[model samples]
Target: PSVKSVIQGFLPGLALKIFLIMLPKLIMAMSKMEGYTSFSSLERRSASKYYLFVLVNVFLGSIVTGTAFQQLEQLINQPSSE
Candidate 1:
C-alpha cells in the first residue's frame, strides 16, 4: 500500500481510539456538571426494584422457554410410520 493510503487507513482508526478513550472522561465531566455524584434513598429503591423486575422477567421467560422446548422435542422425536 502507498504511504497516503496507509495513513488514511490508520488515521480513522487512531481517531476512533482516541475518541473512545476520551468518551468516558467526557461523560464523567458532564455528569459532574449536572451534580450527578450523589445518590439518594429513592435511587436505591429504584435500583432494588429494577433488580426484582429483572428477576421476575427471567423467571417467567425461563418457564415459557422450557415449555416451548419441551413441545419442540416431543414433535421432533415422534416415531416415523413406514
Candidate 2:
C-alpha cells in the first residue's frame, strides 16, 4: 500500500489511543476538584467516565468504516432495520 494509505490508517488509531489514555486522567483530575472524601468516590468517578467512553465507541463501531466519523453519515441515512 502507498505511504498515504498507511498513514491514513495510523492516524485515527493513534488519535483514539491518545483519547483513551487522556480521558481517565482527565476524570481523575476533575474528581479531585470536588475534594472527594474517599478513594471509592474517585475510583467510581473514573470508572464511570471510562465506561461512558467505551459505550460510545462500541455503539458507533457497529457502523465502522475507515474512520468512525465517516460512518456516521451513512448511519444517519440508514433504515432502522439495519
Candidate 3:
C-alpha cells in the first residue's frame, strides 16, 4: 500500500488509543467543574460519565462500522454493468 493509505489506516487506531487514555482525566476535569463537594461524589460522577461514554462509543461505532462493511461487501460483489 502507498504511504497515504498506510497513514490513514494507522491514524484512526492511534487517535482512538490516545483518546481512551485521556478519557478518564477529561471526565474527572468535567466532574470537578461541576462542583462536586465531596471526593466520593466527584468520583461517582466521573465514573458514570466514563461508563456512558464507553457504552455509547462502542455501541455506535459497532453499528456504523458494521453497516459500512456490509455496504463495502455489496459494492465489491456487485456486477460492474450498473
Candidate 4:
C-alpha cells in the first residue's frame, strides 16, 4: 500500500481529535489569564479566544498528525532490507 493516502486519512482524524481535546483547555487557560470567572465573563473570553484556538489547533494538529502519520508509515512499512 502507498503510504501517502494513509498519511492523509490519518492526519484529519488525528487533527480533529486533537482539536476537540485542546480547544477547551486553550479557552480555559486564556480565560484564567484574563481573570474571567463568571459565566458571562468566561463566555465572552471564550468566544473570542476560541476562534484563535481553532486556528492554532488546526495548524498545530495538522503538523502533529502529519508527523505522527509519517512515523507510523515508517514503523509499519519500512522493510528490514538485507
Residues 20-72, model 1: lDDT tens digits: 56654555555456565665544544455545644665577679889999989
Off by over 4 Å in 4: 52-82
Candidate with best lDDT: 3
Q: Which scores greater on lDDT, model 1 or model 2? A: 2
- Candidate 2 vs candidate 3: the lDDT winner is 3
Worst 10 residues of 2 by lDDT: 58-67
Candidate lDDT (C-alpha), each: 0.65, 0.80, 0.88, 0.80
Candidate 3 lDDT by residue in tens digits, 26-60: 99988889888798998899999988988889778
Expressed as tens digits, the lDDT of each residue in 6-80 for candidate 2 is 889898788888888888888888888979868899999889978986877755565564477666767888846
What global local distance difference test value does model 1 have?
A: 0.65
Residue 57 in candidate 2, Cα distance off native in Å: 4.1
Model 1 scores worst on lDDT over the 10 consecutive residues at: 41-50
Model 3, position 82, has a per-residue lDDT of: 50
